[model samples]
Target: MTFESPSASGLTRRGMLTGAAAIGAGSVGLATAPAAAAPLTARGYRTRVVLAGTAGGPPPQDGRLGICTVVLVEDRAYLVDLGPGAVTAYARAGLTMEQVQSVFITHLHSDHLAEVYNLFWLNYGAPGARGNISRSVGIYGPGPAGSVPQAPGAPVQQPEAPTPGLTDFLRGAVAATAYDLNTRMAESRKPDIWNVLDPHDIELPDIGASATNRAPDMEPFEVMDDGFVRVTAILVDHPPVFPSFAYRFDTADGSVVVSGDTAPSDNLVRLARGADLLVHEVYDHAYFATINPRLAETFSRTHTASDRVGQLASAAGVGTLALSHLVPAGVRDVPDQVWKRHARKSFGGTVVVGRDGDTIGIGGRTK
Candidate 1:
């Protein structure tokens, strides 16, 4: 039951060296490593998770983009969330949108969903998306909040249907772009928008989950089961945002859990238990408190701190802990080494301080 600890160079477990390789000119490990030394490819691993965009929050950071993660199994790509710069990052990582089979949204947060529509609208019928021209890309996300959670000074917009789900969101996206979509369909050779993106609201089983008690302790439930992979979901503790989820992707090769946005929760640990990799969100309490005390207080309750991530990873018994969705994501704001040091304090497994395009190979050779 013993696990090999990470080396200073990279994460090594039982002779498995998870790449932690950066696709940009950034440090790949605790020590200085060559930039882009390992290009992203499906050759080495049976499954891999690419950190498409690492920065957290709505405002743009200096080097990193917003939060988006891609779990790749062979040629098929399953995306967890699509943030502002995810589409472009997908191309930059030498991957085409055609490779994407399904897209999962953790919550309806603007930072996590800003570019979701753009992902399909811009790419469909384009040269890169030729392969899936006839196939509909599945979009799965939380259903509508049963009732809006109360908050001070927060006026409800769209009072008729205060909270909309994935289906409604996609409907709005198409409506907002109706002019463009119609024009392209008539003038340009764009295919029917409906045929390109298929949206679904995930049906939550009766689990006593509500806007007030957002994340109740429960076993992971099956979300989707494509022939190649089985996806399961568990509610995580990101309050005021009901139905926020952490997802686990299991393939024949291995499993990885994407902790969408949450404070440390046992539900997450249970969902990610014994998975080969745990990709989790992290915030720096000290740094954010100095910048904005009010926002820091909110983050402290909703997101996991860097120092506490390892404890969750250890509790989950994940092989490696890859930190993404970083708050205060600027390279100058908080260095990678700081994240590594903090995470290492509580867990013995490998900890990867994720950069925008870093790809970590799992259950196979390190790239």
Candidate 2:
């Protein structure tokens, strides 16, 4: 998005730092005391996954593929993805976009990255009341892959293309929005409009973007500070869409993993081993089997089926399974009994079908 001129009442670095400090202190109810210094491992961290856009295709419930948008709340806020409805979901979940410190993209799928531009614009142009923060938000994602685009109906193969890699696409998109961002901010009086700090001031990097340098194996890569908790990503196989990832977050009290969008794979099981929770995408096999044949075919080509998800969760010994990125099946389509029958056959642990605003606490502490 485009950038607006700096605010007339531009906040200085010192003022911004002071404001951040105050917010940090107040959030934890330690505003009046000398900063209680503690190692990252000692301080508790929390995570909230918001189902931004449930429906994937056209609006009015065609299908929901609003890929994952997880919020990692620690000393600072880190967002995992920016699905279509993530902005609204964040607000519904009582989170202000302004407080988000960074955004980590899993892939370049439209459903996954559709909200990136909106998020950037919202933070940089919207009024203050809509969760706009001035802090520079970091954006991270995988780099490009060398591949030729196949014609429609051609046999699908490894390394699909036509869509520039995440790095190139984001760079161009952000660069193009510069003018629009500036114009909107200048026209709006809301505090949200002031949230967009200069894009030049923000750090946007394509982590593991290049195929050669990309960590293709299922190993977790630490993304942020390790003081209170450590966050890492593991490569998972989602073929024809190489370089997909599943992320794990470990805190002192507990650990959690976010299985972005992948078919059942051993990579996920290994990554999730010993985690307290696994937030994974699940598709109802029976429901899809009986629905529109075309849609079912598309589903198979892209995501994991429900039974597979159950098996993966079971094998990993995950403590809890929070099913997200649900398919078109509504309550009637996949009744409780059907879900229980399939899920219980594999995962004996607690299995929750996540809703838009559902909150599952990883550690035993209340935030």
Candidate 3:
């Protein structure tokens, strides 16, 4: 699907911020979506899943963005990653930024966090956001990414580092946007962006893992509870990127487990035990069987192979397994049948190669 990215003139951010109808019935960008999309179900389910993004990484693509998924529990929505085009995909899914109550980051890689600022930008800027989206939105995720030297003979640079935690990321994002905030604040009607979010650095257990450290034995910990749902975080292996996480959202009606990004993880399997749906990342090694060893090492190091994803889902007893964040995604032209066949090699459960706007209803709604 062709995405019509928003422009400053098309629908004024100022209009949206002031409660004016920033979008019309078929406004471009946020309103009129592409031809690739299908109609949403006429009857809404109590628990549903929206695959907002299915692309794997930083490389720009036409139809997909980086990994992002929105689990709609009843009427509330919670985000797993704010990848590039996240807000665009949300609007394309017939959802507004205001519906997002909290955001959960698996890890702080730029791919996963690309459009986060937009969330803060539009969520707080929308008219009446103060009263409706009034509460501090919860932002949850892993802590620092630990310092690592450039690969051997690489570029002349110091050890790499990312913000220490979600708190720091939010703080830094806000500070970076100070100019915009200050300018907007001149209007007495603006809501303070600082008060719009409640950032929590998920407390890592002393079993020990920090952004920089590794703790292989990941135990599940209940992190935060928005009135509608309770979220659980567990460590997963995305080595070199320590303290990576997989999250589970448990509501009264159903449950969904999101494997943020990882190699096969026992901790992820444990967390997804008896889940209604498992949204995971997958790469097809067969497509790159003879690629450079270094690139191969990178794939083996950070992502779960397609077959292993099936094994993990089957082991965890999830009712449905949906693969998002497809490495080399649709552009590579590896047919869906190929992916489905690869997954069937290991497990025998319902499997799907997820796409941008694909919606699935859990608690027994099948493909």
Candidate 4:
């Protein structure tokens, strides 16, 4: 028997080009763009969401990327997660790669951060289409505490402590590019990327640390407030992957929440309450069993179930519910129609089945 790679979700470079054309002059993606929202005039900027990559994973497959989203606040693009196909989708969304000033990681999962350095590497070029970002780029994530789990019941044989936190991860990223950083500064007369990277390790407030079932919640707090927009992150449970987060962006236009990757989390519901849009991760509950049961089972515990996502949306009272980070979005049997129905069952509000390259404007309440 032979296997074949799945298609790229009916999206292509040409399609991206066309989609970008619609965004020309800072207009929204399609005619359905909200009316009351502020245009990208010199004074104010509206908030829009671009689901750069939508697949959550064991490893990116079926032409789906890991998980990434770009929140556009006026001219600025704030990226969340750095999944595999993120860069491509960023370009597809008509966003300049170099202008990406901040990247917020929900957690330290490989699939979520695999492509960050790739973006930073390009962001540091010698001033051209290859990213000429002038100011420092800020990288933020949870403070020290191994995101991984410890060996069980081995008091004397406990393993060495896990990587400290985002700060240590930042070190690893620099080390991975040490040769390039040194060679560029020493040989090419180019500025080193380290000079422009500002890494901040955020400590969650016990304020939101909902400590349910023994795992400490990641309590919410404002991580970035650059005047144009304020980004807040709340801790959600995705165990053994302690300190997982879900973010909310309150901009001039409206409020938008990105539910990283979590099971049924009260914190997420609380943060997303009354939000204009809720972009939540959802798996096809019916089809999850069809995939590898071991992985499916583990993911089922950590990832949100489809129907519950709908319930969460309803509970949050978000104007719009957009589902992404699909667990098996590409499984032939689990077409979007089948999966959407799962969420729709409980959600009466607007529901959109997310796709890579999909741009959702965050202007006003939907319902």
Candidate 5:
């Protein structure tokens, strides 16, 4: 049986109109009408977590590699993680770097954040390179906030300690790019070279930037002026690496949770509990066990096993479980049916194994 879409969650006509208004401000001058204007019953919002890179064990024929990128689209587009293949994947997904409003990093794992520099440069190089528009894209994630003092058991003194702390590691990169941006602007005689230009050479800044960058720490939690959607972020354990987060997105239509890279944790279960969709990272324990013991050990440390993922979804009673962050063993080999079988043994809900570009429409009846 198919699962009910989030639209089927029972949104009133007024609720739909409210959501539409929330996202409308950004739709000005668009070639096509905004998706939000579509009837809520017609599946107004579409969220896709495009697979940027998928690699573990032996490489695939396409030369892809380890847990990579994903882009989350709502009223505005937000990129979840930017692994190695993110740049290429973004292009493949038909997304221009300028269209992305903010980048929400799950954690600082190289595999997840590798493309940050690429995305930053892409945005920074846009026509209005030095303008507020270029600097408008916000990047949020967990990292050391300040100096680590030598005090014993001293609460690991991270000076600023914001929810998604800013680390110094990225400071140099931003500084290094200054000269290049200046050179490009001077040579082109254009201020916003990196931005997408209209026929008249006018740059189109991401409309969502103003609302999203206003409060970085309060992200996925604060509701935009549109009033149709709200996002909340909760800390989850992905230790050795402290402070990973699971994000929950609530809209007039329904709720969806993105379980960023993390081992099975109660925080995730609670974050996803009762949501219409749970997009989680899953690793193949059985396959890894046979391929390489060391790899298997690493998998255990970094991610949730398939069975454990299933259990979490079942325990949380999510409406649908979409497995993602796949490793080598082909997507079809993911034992999708097994998840359904076991989850049914427990939760008896719909289980979906996410494929690259697979779109799961929420908030509507199965047509």
Candidate 6:
């Protein structure tokens, strides 16, 4: 796989000092620029993966944004997960909202879906983006979980429909922003939102899955096939967030898998098997273990550590492993080298610690 950061202007002394000051100030500096021709070339490859946000969880971190990724097939963009600031990051990556053909959500976590509405609402009619959405863009995600999971003896919040699916979430967004949508329709005569955006709830086959048995071992099933790419999903172990998924996109160029928040799940390994690129999430076990032991323990059960991610990639025989959705995403708290070191301990293939806008290309004439 070929890797490049779109805004890698090379370390300037001023930029170095600025980064240092931001780290000292305990603030994340996640500024990115539009794509350049050199980065987009991809050595003649047709398929590429762009890391929009690398930070995991809700709280913003230093040097990293939330978790979002874009898979590019020629000019079309298929997005996976729209975390905080993802809409802006998508634009910063030189991707026009008009190029968005489909969106796949891994789960309903706030950090993962924070900007789901913003992506569409903001891009619907921006300058140079108006009247361009002729085809419906499909947004797919897990359906509502039948039941909610809570800690033993803990009371469940929003017991009724505790887990809203993608369709329900989109409907709620429309309702919550009814005033604005209505005003735009009356004044600007904008196209109906439903006419452009198609939201769907991914249906699951009978595989003995449940709120408790979140990810029973199963085969990766088809979620979509839009001629350009064939998308498949499998249950991944992110407990309490039932129906959590890991998606794989198979294109003529090659295959790329996005392991949404998960532990070292066999289901993920299966979904990613033999893929060219596995963009996986990772946690800093050492950092979490020191700051919050209980939370670290909980994360260990819900997330895969750096070494475990490496093992999973190795087991899947993926050509490359790109690590994103970092738990402690701060450069000061968990440096890139630290993440690389832990992952390399278990896997021998290429390990890429992705930053926002970093592009990984597969197949074609490799660089």
The TM-scores, one per candidate, come to 0.88, 0.72, 0.82, 0.81, 0.65, 0.90
User: Model 3: clashing residue pairs?
Assistant: 144-211, 146-212
List per-prediction Cα lDDT, in the order shown. Answer: 0.79, 0.56, 0.71, 0.69, 0.52, 0.80
Question: Which 10-residue window of candidate 3 scores lowest in summed lDDT?
Answer: 1-10
RMSD of 4: 7.8
**How well does model 2 score by local distance difference test?**
0.56
| Candidates 5 and 6 compared by lDDT, better number | 6
Per-residue alpha-carbon lDDT of candidate 1 for residues 1-367, written as tens digits (9 for 90 to 100): 1112223333223113333433332224221122212235434566767776888888878877778898888878899888877666665554666688999999999989998998888777645423334479889999898788767998988889999998999999999999999998888788898997899899987999999889988999999999889999999989889889999999887898999999999999999999988999999888988989998899889899999999999998998898999988887888888999999999998778887666666675544
State which candidate, 2 or 5, has the greater lDDT.
2
Ranking 3 against 5 by lDDT, winner: 3
Model 5 TM:
0.65
After superposition on all CA atoms, what RMSD does each candidate show versus the true structure?
Answer: 5.8, 12.1, 8.6, 7.8, 12.4, 5.3
Cα lDDT tens digits for candidate 5, 277-327: 887877777777998989889879767887677788878888777766666
Model 4 residue 160 CA deviation (Å) reads: 4.1
Best by lDDT: 6
Worst 10 residues of 2 by lDDT: 26-35
Off by over 4 Å in 1: 1-39, 128-134
Residue pairs clashing, model 1: none
Per-residue accuracy of model 4 over 240-287 as CA lDDT, tens digit each: 665678899988778889988888888898889889889899876666
TM-score of 1: 0.88
| C-alpha RMSD in Å of predicted model 2 compared with the true structure | 12.1
* 38-141 per-residue lDDT for model 6 (tens digits): 23324356887888788898887887778888899987889999998777667656666677899999999998999988777766753442224546889999
Superposed by TM-score, candidate 1 places the C-alpha of residue 115 at a distance from the truth, in angstroms, of 0.7
Backbone clashes under 3 angstroms, per model: 0, 30, 2, 3, 25, 2
